[model samples]
Target: MKATVSWQQALTFSGKTESGFSQTLDGNGETLSPMETVLLAVGACSSIDVVDILKKRRLTIHDCQCELEADRAEEPPRVFTKIHAHYIVSGDNLKEKDVDRAVSLSAEKYCSVMLMLKGNVVITTSYTIVD
Candidate 1:
């Protein structure tokens, strides 16, 4: 839960996590901006929940991908106003109902990032299963 950000030069920084992971962040479009990182965090967090939930349901999952589209406010803060998560799931004997339930559960109950932004962000989800 602990991390540090160091100035790298000219609107760029290096972030190191407690787990020894690091990433480069830049505001000059050389790397992912702070806003882009937030979008990525939400997508990755929810996708992890979806994958875990499906696995717990005994579903045979071969691959899972989540595509996220977000709209930000026009003001200076530019907070996310809306987000849509489109999940592409590939597996054998994948039930549509299971996928639906997994995504619903992740958004409503499991994904912390999604829950944190629930009140302010309009979040929607959909899925396609490839057999």
Candidate 2:
């Protein structure tokens, strides 16, 4: 439940998670932002459930990616007012029904980030299944 972020350079940083894994975070030349980390948190939170739900349902999952969009408030400290998560799943024999159900389960109950942010942020999701 801890992490460390070290400055890598201007507008960029390297973050080490409690598990010792690392990732590079950058702002594409703008000032360093925490929004990227928030998005990553949301993605990671939902992805865990997505995979687990698919596995429990015996779905053959080849790959998955989630894209998120956030609208921030205009104030001294920007906060997300809304978030949209798009899940694109690729697999063999993937069922649209399962995908829909998995997403619903995650957003409605499974994802910790979704639950924690639910009251403050409006979260929505869409899915694309490729077979």
Which candidate wins on TM-score?
A: 1
Tens digits of per-residue lDDT for model 2, 1-131: 99999988877888899999987778774543577778788998998899889999987899889989899999957889999999999888998989999999999999998899888999999999987
Q: Where does candidate 2 clash, by residue pair?
A: none
Model 1, 58-130: lDDT tens digits are 8889989999999999997889999999999998899999999999999999999999999999999999999
Query: Per-candidate TM vs. native?
Result: 0.97, 0.80
TM-score of 2: 0.80
Stretch of 10 with least lDDT, candidate 2? 27-36
lDDT of model 1, residue 64: 90
Model 2 scores a C-alpha lDDT of 0.88
What stretches of model 2 exceed 4 Å from their correct place?
4-15, 22-32
